[model samples]
Target chain A: MEFEMKIDYYSGDPGEFIKVIEEKCTGCGQCAKFCTRDVWEADGKIYRPINLKDCVECGACWNICTADAIIFGDPKGGTGVRFTHG
Target chain B: MTEDNFFDVIVVGAGCAGPAAAKKTAELGLKTLLIEKSPEPGTKTISGTCINLAGMHNEDLYYILKGPIEREIHSMRTYHINDARTTVFNEIPTKGVLLLSIRRDIFDAWHTEQAKLAGAEVKLSTTVTDIIEENDYVCGVITDSGEEFRCKVLIDAAGVNSIVGRNAGLIPKRSGDNMILYVTVAVELGEEVINDRFSDEQGGYCIEYYLAPGIQYKTWPWIFPKKDTVTLGTGGYMTKDLFNDKITNVNQYMQNFLNLPIVKRKLEGGKIVSWGLHLEYDEKISQKVKNGLILTGEAGGFVIPFLGEGMSPAFATGIFAAKTAAEAIQKNNFSKESMSSMYEDMIEEDLFLQGFMHVGKINKESILKKSEEEISNMMQSVVLGGGFITNAVHTKWLEGAENGDIEKVQEALDFLEFIQPYRQIGSEFEEIYRKLRAEGGS
Candidate 1:
C-alpha cells in the first residue's frame, strides 16, 4: 500500500525566491540532496531545480551548500506552505 | 543607519531563544531589538513530537507562548523491532510529572508576541548578514539590506544554523557526524481518531521510540500524538557517507518508518498536512560566550543529545543570556572576562550541562550490546530519573542480576549504590528515589 503525501509549494514574483549561481556551483549536488521538498534535481553533471514551485523557502539548500551556490530568500507574503491544522 | 540605530542589546533570530532573551532584556529596561530572518517568528521553526517541560517553571518563557497545551504526557513506551515487544513506563499515583505538547509554529508566534509586549522592538524578515567587530569585540551587526545596527551586547540565538555565532568566530561549525537530521510530517487524524488509537481520554499523550537493527543512530524513530495530529519522524547521526546516501534522501527513511507495522497500524487513515526538516547539534561544543556576545539555544549546542529536546534548554539559556547581558550593561563591562563568567559559568551549572554529561556517559555501542531486558531496565530508569541520572533501581535490575549478564547488573547496581547516600540526604535525589519506590520499583 502507498501513503498519499501532499505538499503546498509557494513561489513569489519572478526573481524573488531561490537563485543558484551557476558559476559558483561546483556540481556538488548538496542542494539537490539536502532539500526534502525535492525542489532541486541532479542531471549527473550538476544540480538544477526541477520543481522550483515546490520550494517552501526553508533555506536548507542555501545553508547546506558548501560552494555558496544557492541563494534563498523568503517568498512574498501568503506564498509559502500554509499550515491548516498546525 | 545613524547613531540612533544603536541599542543596549540586539538579539538575532526570534525563535524560542531569541524572543525569550529579548523579553528578559526589555523587561529589565534595556533598549533591546529582536530580529528574525523569517517573515515571522515560528515560520522557519520545526520540532519533534513534544517538548519535555521537566525543568521549566511557571515563570518560564515557554508559558509565554500561550499555545494551547494539547496533552499532558504521563507515560512513555519503547518498542524494540527485534522482539516486536514494548516496555511501558507509567508515572505513578494517577499522574506524576507531565510534558506539554503544542504545535511549534503556534508556540513560537505567541512567544514573539510576548517579547513585543515586554517592550522589545521586533523586526521581521530582517536577516543579520554579518557580525561587525572592532578590536576583536563584536559590537554590531550588518543586516542584508545594507543597514547596520550597533549594540553594547549581541545575543546569538540563531538555532542550529548558528549564523551569527559561526560568523563571529564564537562557535565552531557543526559537522555531519555531530549533527542529527530530523525529517518530520505532521498528519491530521482528527481528535477522535487520535484519542481512540492512543487510549488517551484526558488529553494525555504517549511517546513511542523505535529501535531497529541496522540503523546507525542509537535513537532511531518516534511517533508522537498531538491534539488532532500525529508527528512522525526519524532521526539518526549524520555520517559523511550517510550524508551522501541516506541523509540526503531522508524521504526514503520516512517511508521506511511509515511502512513499519507499528506505525502503519496507528496512522492508517491520517492525511499528511506539513513536511519539514530540522538540523540539531547533538554533540557539545565549547566557547558559547565571547566579548560583547552570548550564544543561546541550538546556536550554543544546548539541545540534549539522547532525547533530542531543545525547547526547555533553549528557554532556560535564553533567560540566562538575557540576565547576563543585563548585568554587562549595568556594570558597563562588555569584556570577554566579565561576559564569559556571567554566561558560561552559569550555563555550566544549568540542567542542560548535567543532561549532556549523563548522555555522554551512555555510549551507543554499550547500549546496543545490552540484552533486551537490560535495555528496558536502563530506559525505565532513565525515564524515572528524568533522563539525567541512572540511579533509580527497578525489579528488573534484580531479575537481571539473577538471569541476565552479571556485569551489566553489577554496573547498574554500582551506580545505584553510589547514589545511595544522597537518597537519605533529603535532597532532590531523595525525592527521585521516593518516587521510584512509590512506583513499586526499587
Candidate 2:
C-alpha cells in the first residue's frame, strides 16, 4: 500500500523546517531531483545538505524523499494548491 | 419500453476529465450521471509529473482543487548529461498561472465530491461494458452486471485504455509504438533533512531531465514534490513486441539511476517505498466526438507528445466537454457534427495541444536521428531561441540554419509567433535551454 502525507513548508521556524533521520536516510537522491533549493548533494552515495539555511520550506523535497528520512513541523495556517479553476 | 430514466448527460470515468465535465454539467442544472469503474474515485488514476494551470477557469477550478492539491509549481529546472551544468527559468504565458502537484487518488476523490455537491450522481466501483446505439447515434450504455442506463449524451473519459471509444467505432485500434509506459516510486524524507538539502530554490517545485543515452524511446524522468511525498518516474516509447512484454526488472534501472553522478550526488541517502504505473496514449486523437458519444483526456489522445504531460489538458477538456454537452442537451442535439465542434474548439484553445501538434510530428526524427553532440547543439538552440514552445517552434529555423541566410534577430521574432499564446513563457524555455547547454559544455 502507498503511504501518503502532506506537510507545510511555511510552518514553524525556518531554521528547524528540516528534520533528518540519519538511519532512515539511505542517500538514494530521489529527493534531490524534486528539490529546487539544491539542498542535498551526494557525498559517496549518501546525501547531505550542501547548506541547510537556504530552504524555501516548500516541503516538496520532504514529501518525495523516500526511506521516511525527511519530516516537517506543525501544520501551516492555510490550504495548499490554491487553484484559479480546474 | 420501460419508463426511461433519462439524465441530460452521462459521463463515464470519474478521473480528471469526467469530473470536470460532471461538475460543469451539474452546475448548469443538466441532469448528470458520473460513472466510475474504480472501487473509489481516482483509485485507478495515474497522472504524469506536473499539471500546468494553463487553461484553468478560475472560479470553478479554485472550488474543486483547493483541498486536494499538494503544492503549486512556480518554477522549473532542466538538466543535461553534464554534471557541471543546468538550466532554470521563471517565466510563462501568465504570472498567475500555476500548476498543482496532486495525488491522483486524493484529487479524483475530491473532484467526485465536488461534482456530487453540484448535484451530479456518482456511480463508483461500477463498470460500463457497452454503448447502445441506434441509427449511428448513441442512446445509452450497459454495465457488466446486466444493468442498463440510458442517456441523451455519453462521454468517454476512460483514459489511454479507453474501451468506449473503440467499441463505439469512434477510433481504430492503436499500435505499440504509440504507447508509453511509466513506473513511479513515491519516496518520503524528513523536513529538516530536506530543508538543509535544497535551500537554494524559491518555492518547493519540481524538476525534469533528458539524461544521457537519450533516444527516441528514452523519454525524460520527472521529480514531482507534493505535500509530504515526492513522485518520481521515467517513461519511453515502445514497439508492439516490447510493449506487450512484462517489465523485466525496474529495480535494476532504478539502481543504475541511483549511481548516476547527479542522482548519487543529490539523493545519496534517499529511499523508495511504493511503485505505480502510468499508461501512455497509444494513438493521436483525430476525432473526439460522435453522434452520441465524446472522448476526453488520454481517451482522446491529448497527451503532450514531447513532454508527455496531459493533466492540464485533461482537466480543461473535462470542463469544455461538460459545457458542450449541456448546450447540446438544451438544443436537443447530440449529432456527431455538433459534438465534433467541441473537440475542435478545445484542441484549438489548448496550448499543450497546439505546441504538441505543431512540433509532435518531428519528435521521432529529432530524438532518433541525432547523436549526443547534435542533440546538445539542438538543445542550445532551444535555450537561446527563448521559451519552451518558442524554442521548439524555432526548430524549423535550425533546419534552415544549414543555409546560413536566416537573420539571427528575426529567428527570435519568428520563434515568438510560433509560441502564440505561450509567448510569455519564452524566457522560461530560454533559461532551461541555457542551463542544458551549460551542462553540456561543462
Top candidate (lDDT): 1
Badly placed stretches (over 4 Å) of model 1 are A1-35, A39-86, B57-67, B83-94, B200-203, B213-217, B240-248, B360-388, B391-442
- Candidate 2 C-alpha lDDT tens digits along B87-158: 443233243325566777777777788889989998875667678898888887787556788888888887
Please give the TM-score of chain B in predicted model 2. Answer: 0.82
lDDT string, candidate 1, B1-442, tens digits: 7767999999988777898899999999999999887665675666734656455532454344244456556556666565555444444325443466677666677778888999999988676768999988889888767789999999999877656887876665444656666667788889889887865434456666666543324454776778888877775555445444443466666777777776788888887877766676766657788888888988887876565567778888899999999999989999888988888777766543454444444544344456545665666566666553443234325546778667667765765665454334334432453354355421
Native A-B interface contacts kept, per candidate: 0.15, 0.00
Question: Model 1: which residue pairs collide?
Answer: none
Q: Mind giving the per-residue lDDT tens digits that candidate 1 earns over A1-86?
A: 14344554334342346777877888987777667778888766678877877665545676567787776544443345543323
- Determine which window of 10 residues in candidate 2 chain B has minimal summed lDDT: B240-249
Candidate with maximal TM-score: 1
